[model samples]
Target: MKPEKLSDIKKELAGRTVQELTEICLRIAKYKKENKELLNYLLFDSDDPLLFSEKVKTFLEEDFKAMQKHYYHSTKSLRKILRIMNRYAKYTGNKQVEVEFSLWFCTNFLHYADLNTSHKPLQAIFIRQLEKISRLLPKLHEDLQFDYQGEFETLLHKADSQARWVSKSLYL
Candidate 1:
């Protein structure tokens, strides 16, 4: 069976009593981890998007410290970290959180993993995040964009100075 449209779902939900709605939500949360996570965020973390993002960053920092330095594991770890970050960002419906968290991720990724191993996939993942930042920057508020741009440029400079693979020109 096909899923109902969001508008139709909303209309149906609007007709329900509060108790019924709560029961429905609990039932939905029982079926999927993402639904439960979204409920948790809405109930506990939605008040402070910045705090939620910071929590995610701290979790990522720990993951980075634990990451294996080998190229294969490192790439796998990066993908996992991004998956976690993206999930949190998706809950907030905020571009700034996504952009800021990604920048922090890329910078930490550079410091946590050695770049001179001639692993193109690792380098490409790094560049892909920079490209994501470029795409997202224009969508954020002007003041935040300015601040993140400075950090972005500084990140690019650090990358350029430290590795031949990360070119500042292509991203900016």
Candidate 2:
């Protein structure tokens, strides 16, 4: 069955009382893991976006380090990392945070993985993230967009260079 349009859903929700809306939210959260995660973020983690992004950054750094040092599952690990980053972006619902997260992911991926050109899937994931960064840049404030654009350019150039500069230091 086709779902109702967003406007219709908004109208229906607008008519609901506070307790009724809370009940509906709780019921929805019970049915899906993602829904539950989003609800938790809204309820508890939405106060300080900078703090949330920093937490995500720290998590990403740790995961990337672990993958680099121990995990041999290249494509699988990269996909998992990207999925987590995307999920965090969804939680914040902020374009700036999304862009920052994407930038950090790309930076860390380049530094840690230096993705072998022969690995098509891994390369595709990197390219897809760059595309996401490009898409998100325009949605940011003009000054922020200009700043991120510089970083994005650096990443693009790094991707273009055939030479792989894998950092000897494992921790980024």
Candidate 3:
């Protein structure tokens, strides 16, 4: 999506009820999951970590740019959301949201290159940071307090649980 389009989406989102916002967020999550699944297939099947990493990096860069285009306004709720995402990115050794692109790139590369053994520490660090961010989602939803806040919190918890499962699976 173009930056202008994303900005328009953000504006539209701002006017929505909490329930609407939660629905939109769920859609976004679905999109991300679908994209990630496709990426995984490409990475694992192609046996080309470097190429996969480059593609992931490009995708992440675009996503970060889109997020940046929607700079939070003078609203506490919007500010909190942006802050949470920013902190999450920082905790994951990402200086900017765009860094997720690079990190994912590196992760795929490591996995394909059989570098996982050597990169376990880095992977653990990333997962821990993601966990922290996942834990903060409920607080963020509470602060926003739309009618579906509870449902959003539940979603966040599920995401956290899934993250924990993935972390343990990777280690084991």
Highest-scoring model, lDDT: 1
Which of the two, 2 or 3, has more lDDT? Answer: 2
Residue range 82-132, candidate 2, lDDT tens digits:
889889898898998998888898888777774555566666677677778
Instruction: Assess the local accuracy of residue 119 in candidate 3 as a C-alpha lDDT between 0 and 100.
Output: 39
Model 1 TM-score relative to the real fold: 0.97
Give me the displacement of residue 114 in model 2, in angstroms. Answer: 4.5
| Regions of model 1 farther than 4 Å from truth | none
**Which stretch of 10 consecutive residues in model 3 shows the poorest summed lDDT?**
69-78
RMSD of model 3 against the true structure:
18.4
lDDT of each: 0.91, 0.78, 0.41
Worst 10 residues of 1 by lDDT: 109-118
Instruction: Judging by TM-score, tell me the better candidate of 2 and 3.
Output: 2
Candidate 3, pairs of clashing residues = none
- Alpha carbon deviation, residue 59, candidate 3 (Å): 8.2
User: Which regions of candidate 2 fall more than 4 Å away from where they truly are?
Assistant: 68-72, 114-117, 157-172
| TM-score: model 3 vs. ground truth | 0.23
